[model samples]
Target chain A: MDQPRVGLFVTCLVDLFRPVIGFSAVALLERAGCQVEVPTDQTCCGQPAYNAGDLKNSRSIAQSVIRAFEDFDYIVAPSGSCAGMLRAHYPDLFKDDPEWSPRANHLAQRTHELISFLVDIRGMASVENVGFEAQATYHDSCSGLRELGVKAQPRRLLATVEGLDLNELPGAETCCGFGGTFCIKYPDISNRMVADKTADITATGADLLLAGDLGCLMNMAGKLKREGSTTQARHVAEVLAGMTEGPAIGEPEKAPGT
Target chain B: MKPQSHLFKENAKKALNDANLARALNNMKAGFQDKRRATIAKLPEFQDLRDQARDLKNHTLENLDFYLSRFEDRVTEKGGHVHWARTPAEAREAVLEICRSVDAKTVTKGKSMVTEEIGLNDFLIESGLTPIETDLGEYIIQLRHELPSHIIAPAIHLNKEDVAETFRENHTQLDPNRRLDQVQDFTDEARAILRQKFQSADVGITGANFLIAETGSTVIVTNEGNGDLTQVLPKVHIVVASIEKTIPTLEDSATILRVLARSATGQEYSTYTTFSTGPRRPGDLDGPEQFHVVILDNGRSALLGTEAQDTLRCIRCGACMNHCPVYGSVGGHAYGWVVPGPIGAALDPGLIGLEEAHDLPNASTFCGKCAEVCPMKIPLPKIMHHWRVKEHEAKLSPPRFRQGLAMWAWFARRPRLYRLGANAAIGMLGRLGAKRGRFAKLPLAGGWTAHRDLPAPSRGTFQQQWARHKRSQAPSSS
Candidate 1:
């Protein structure tokens, strides 16, 4: 079997807020025997516009993504929401446009979320034990768990990691409430939801929280930090790729004297 | 019963801060969710039944006019009346007229969202008739002068303590010092009070879970048996239901019924599944003397060809709300209308105008749990998204939100410019919060920073790193 050509859709959040997750994803994909390419023409999965009901711009942006990554044998993203947008919703966006609908469907059919791509597509049974030890729990981002069926794949890979203790978070399937623009639009409700989520995460007594989506990770990390919780948060890819060397997401940068 | 949906945010804020309500909501969260999961796990054909249910509703809705006329003919043949109401006011008026004709002094009521939707209780009271709620949950909330926060569990927003408080105030005839500590005591007291109302009332009003056109039967499922008593004990039985409630056959209703209770209270079947075809027959032992169904369109017919058509397929199982994280957090009243939660977010905009119910749809996280749990396979999130689209197109959303989206869209379309701008923004954020990986506050992001710190970006964007990596890998190319 020849190496599959993979284009990484480093989602807007990963590209802007946490670039390490993207690099971690590349490392994981390469280890799984894929030649990875980060398309320069890629900007976003256009979810912000699509979710905000700006269909025109969502379509245009999706078109650019489609054009950029169409040639790759597979397209994978580190975030479920963005991957879901590309895999599940892109075709729906162009359902009425005769010219673009087939193209959109073609792109959508080839797209996969990172963990699922590694486990399901590559037939990679277990991640190498990175000796990264932590009591960690995984948050199933809504899009990944429900839309893309990404529940067991991440857990399957995590099982192989040597020193990681995986404690299940209560109400793990519930939304962390980042919900893209929902966090900004209805901050109070979003806050209440994330507060509930952090409480659940804390109750698990896990020192670290990991999730596939950067948006949810960022939201949970932000809430945990505000609540002065000691629990650290990071992308699951970072741990699996053995790249948890830097400060965890939302951890403070150390001053020169310190 | 007034459409307070526009005040959803205020209501939600109050709901979140209410400790008693939060406790009540938390209790409901586990029971409903766990029960549904257990029941679903037991039934292997549940998914197939859901698909069958969805298809049945879709078929009935597509030929709704035909099914409705067929239902009317069947009901009329069975010596019953079907009153068509174009609006809530008309439905209320029709119910009032029926009560007036009966010279009814009091009406015993079963739980009916449609009646609450039309403000039937207030209308009946103003028309000089007393309407008594017989369902225990309904009775509790009615005594407290509060609308039901939940469809199936009407008093889910109230704790047992709230009920005890309400009972002490409203049931003045009962001994104040008597033991009212247990849940059973509340039920026994409600039954004792409602038993009298049932015997004396001239009319009974109930909501139909499903209206079968084939048998001219209106079905109501209840655990308390209030719906059965409400219909059978009165001279006149009136059922208020939306037009979308009609199904083609009894078999179809049976198929839907399988999923309904499992999705609702997680019972394989409610304790009582009463089917009333019409007024008492000549040979009948016990039943009402008159049967009238107030079939309401209430803007539902207009939704037929639109993106919202799937909403009409809803079985009112409350599964969507039960599984919703937002509804679980704030409880149902925060939605501020007769209908609440995910189903309400999608359906209410059509029933009430979108402008009034605009905030309802936006309240969701698009978690897809509502649709995942929905018995009818209704695409609730997709319907909500449609409402959002409608709100955006009509310029009903805030001007600032629209402008922000527009500006972002403008930058998002040009990748080169987006990369350049995003790279600069990342660098600025990284330096600003270098000492702390998160910001306690930031300009133009108070919504985010109010309750949580915003995580600062890394030193550079992914594109920059990719560019650097490519240059390093191919030394000769640079």
Candidate 2:
């Protein structure tokens, strides 16, 4: 029936920085027997602008995103914050537009963070295992856990991954202080908070640090490298997709042109 | 106690950006936060303590009517009095009545956020009483005629040089050339000035950090011991505090204290956590003749059983602000309220109306640092999101963002058209900016282009590349 389609929103950061999360999401979705379709016009969830007090531009981008993804039966996003923004923030963003408010609610009701959608909606909580192992700690993305309540979704999905050992990090719910523009605007204070967060990661003695959002991943990774620590960082989708085939953590963060 | 945050920021900016002020703020940060961290690290049950503390606050807020009644009964049983203030005006009126009855000309005050909450100092000054702030930081700001930038560290944004200037300006005889370099020097000077006020003042006022339902005791925690002097040295002791500060028992107060000082200054406990049950008992040499507890509701009771109810859990530790990036930069004054940071985001809506402070919740990166470090572990970002939702429901956000959501809701419900439209748009943007691979200018992207470059998407978007891969993987296609 129409190939039982699904739409994957690989947010801007994922598409630009780590393409494999997109691939991993596709692999995992396909294995679940749903034909995954990524709608490309998704420049961003408009989170950067939305967060930076740029409502008009964020609305324009949100409009573009909504127009692009309108037809999907189920819209799945790999990043919880982006998905949460769409489900949680967007409807609020459009409340006054008499026509858009109800419509935004419609999509907000249907949208899901990847793992939660897989387990809760698609019953992929006990999905077929992909064998790959690494000792790692999970960083709970703020918008995802606090905004969307996906704390259990990723854990259940990760539990299905073969050979992975999980350790708890101190202050697990704490922010890595990758406050988007905050990092650039107040880099000194941002670095202090990130250093504290990375120290907690190291104390876990886990070989890797995994999280749902790339904004946080980049922050933690930059601090890990700057402090010259060895623990690597990757997205939760990348780990579940087994896409860690790259230079180790301290490697020159793949220069953009290359 | 501080005034509303709006005036605080304007004054603090003048202080913080002044090169000398920056040198002072930078030097002081390490000592306060580092010592705080060392204190918190030694406490093994910090997180658990926060949970218990948060639960205590929730319990108190839920049964506020009961606790207030019990506290009133106990306060009266001790030959003291209890007065209820539904609003800040009523609170000011009750305090004024006591002052007028006693023919008080001068009032000595410890750092009390509740007094700040009700604008009591200005009201008393207007009524012709010279209110003296006894805490060194509060005294310095009082001399400057400014508001507290922070809850605990009222003068955190101010440095030693600024304090010396304030002293030089206010205390005409103080030697400006005396090299008042150390904070200790400034503290000692302020101490000497306030010691005189404590002796001469007829009435003392302070804010209670917690009001225990079991003992009907009002608790105040401070490092300077000024709160104790304010209560004990005067003939009359007045306590102005919010209803939410009441907990069922001292044990509960103890639980919250674990997270309070740690989340605030990273201290396991402040030097002083004093509790005053009532006036001095018979045979006590150092105590007040009369005691009064003014329970101010303002806007707290309305918060109970609402989506924003979780904010009632805040112990006002100031951790959320200390660790908040937005707060660290713009500081508390920009929030335009007494409470700032994640707590302020929730509170501003209730106090100022959701419309005026709509941007506060949206101001966060949702980085979750505040929630993490919070002693009470309030789900700050979640409450902020709840505010965002309320902003929408209340039509507080600008019209454009809502319309965008409505349109997105429509397209997000479809699939084939979604893919086709997405691909076409990506392809168009890619081709339009192909040579540059980055758009230097886009009329609609004024907000985005202002800050950072919006890089060009690859010609073959993730979807296009993925489609080819899926086809290649299909056995029939291969």
Candidate 3:
């Protein structure tokens, strides 16, 4: 059988902030016996516009995304927010456009967030964990957990990791306050919320924090770094795909003399 | 009540810094949320009940005029007077007229959010009638001269110490040195103080949890029996309810009641689920002689056929706020309205003009937890999004935000320009923070950097890297 063609929707956050997550997703997809193609025309899932209520531009961006990745057997994104944007919101975005609504729905049906795709769609029992030895806790991104129902898939895969001791953050399913534009719009409240989140994360006494969405990971990593906490943060894919050699997100480079 | 929703950001900051409110909110965050989870877990049929409740509310909303008329008719037939109020002012006047007709000196309230919405208490006070709050939380807040932060838990923003202080200040008859340390002590104090008010009040005004058209009944669920005493003790009983509270049948009300208490306080049933139908019948042992139902539309009719129609299904269980992270962080005062949390975020804008309550919708992170836990399954985030669109269209959002979105959308629509822009931005960001791996501050992103650092970008965009990798691997793969 031909390998099912998957178009990697490398979300804008991952594209700009952390490309390794995108590569890690590609590696995991390939390892699961799937052929992945990167669609360069993919800029963003238009969540920023869509979320900000700019429907006109959201629709245009949705149309571009549909035109870019519609031919692939599956459209997969590393971030739940972006994937959820495609799978859940894209249909609604084009609800009025007779020409685009059906196209949006077609693409939505084929879209999946990366981990859920591996566990639910690909039916991969477990991935070969590349021996990431750390006490790591997973923060469930709000979009992924609530929007995509991605609670157990990542954990199910993580259970097979050779040396990963998974300590569940108390409010693991609670939001990390990286609500796209929300963090900027309501920074004070967002900061308080992330402070609560970081407190919960530190309470677990885990050395590392992991989440599926780069937006959330970046947000958490930034908070952890700002507070001068030693706990590192990374995308769940990097650990699962054995690409953990590089410094964790937001970790400063060592001085040349040092 | 004048809306302070425009000051939501400032209010939220103040709430975050309030240590007392933080303690109260933190307690609520765990107690209510966990108990709700536990109770829902015990009931397998909860989800089915939710669906039924949603459908029932949807059906009633669709035929709202029919159900409302039926309710009014049944109420009138059963020796009750029904007054229709198109707005909050009208509702206030209707209540005042009822009180004046009875020559009421004191009006006792039974935790009515609708009354709060209509500013009924203050209106009555201004009209020269004293209003007393019978519910303990309401009584505490009334004494404090503050608003009810949480809907179900009115004084939820107040700690026990705050309540003790409030009681010491208000109840001058009681000894100041009395021990008011325990939760029960606070309740007992409120119970003692409000008991006199409930008895002395000439008229009682209560909000309806559900107005049953089948039986012409106004239902209120409370942990304390204050709602019953407030209505039964008073000579004139007035039920102040919004129009959307009307349900088709008693059975539908029962189905909704099954989820209401469980969702609100995590109890299988509240201590009191009082269903009052019209005035007392002839030869009744103990009941009010006059029963008045003031049905307030107050801008709800405008949302009947709109995308936000789902908001009308809200049972006001407050499970949404109980689970809302934003609400948890800021408590309810920051919302600066009768209703707070996700429900307020969506509904307040519709009730008050969007211009006044615009900030409420944008305050959310669109986390979807509120919608997830809502027994009505009202798509709260979706409703909030609708308001956002309206705000954007009206140019009510900050001009900088609009221009930023416009600029980003311009590039987003064009892939080539987007990639080029992304490439240039990523290169600059990567080089700027290459050593630190993050920026402590950045131009035009103070909102982000004010709280946390922004992680620096990689050297190149993912698309560029993928393209180069693909080019290098083409011959090897073949």
lDDT of each: 0.91, 0.74, 0.90
Scored against the native two-chain complex, candidate 2 gets a DockQ of 0.13
- Candidate 3 ranges with C-alpha deviation above 4 Å: A254-258, B474-478
Docking class of 1: medium
Ranking by lDDT: 1, 3, 2
Provide the lowest-lDDT 10-residue window in model 3 chain B. Answer: B469-478
TM-score of the B chain in each candidate versus the native B chain: 0.98, 0.91, 0.97
Q: Looking at candidate 1, what is the lDDT of residue B331? A: 90
DockQ of each: 0.62, 0.13, 0.64
lDDT of 3 by residue, B167-193 (tens): 888889999889999999988888887
Q: Per-residue alpha-carbon lDDT of model 1 for A1-258, expressed as tens digits?
A: 479999999999999988888888988999999999998888888888888777888999999999999999999999889999999899999999999999999999999999999999999899876767899999999999999999999999888888999999999999998999999998988998999999999999999999999999989999999999999999999889887777788886554322
lDDT at residue B41 of model 1 (Cα atoms): 95
lDDT of 2 by residue, B1-478 (tens): 3324334324434533455544444444455556667887788877677777777777787888898898888888888899999999999999999999999999999998778878889999999998999988788888888777678888877766678788888887776577677878887888888888899999999998888888889999999999999999999999999888888887888787767777677666799999898888889888899999999988888888887788877777787777665565455665677787778876777766676677678666777767777777788876776776666667765576556555644444343455566668767875665554345456765443432234444454565666676668652110
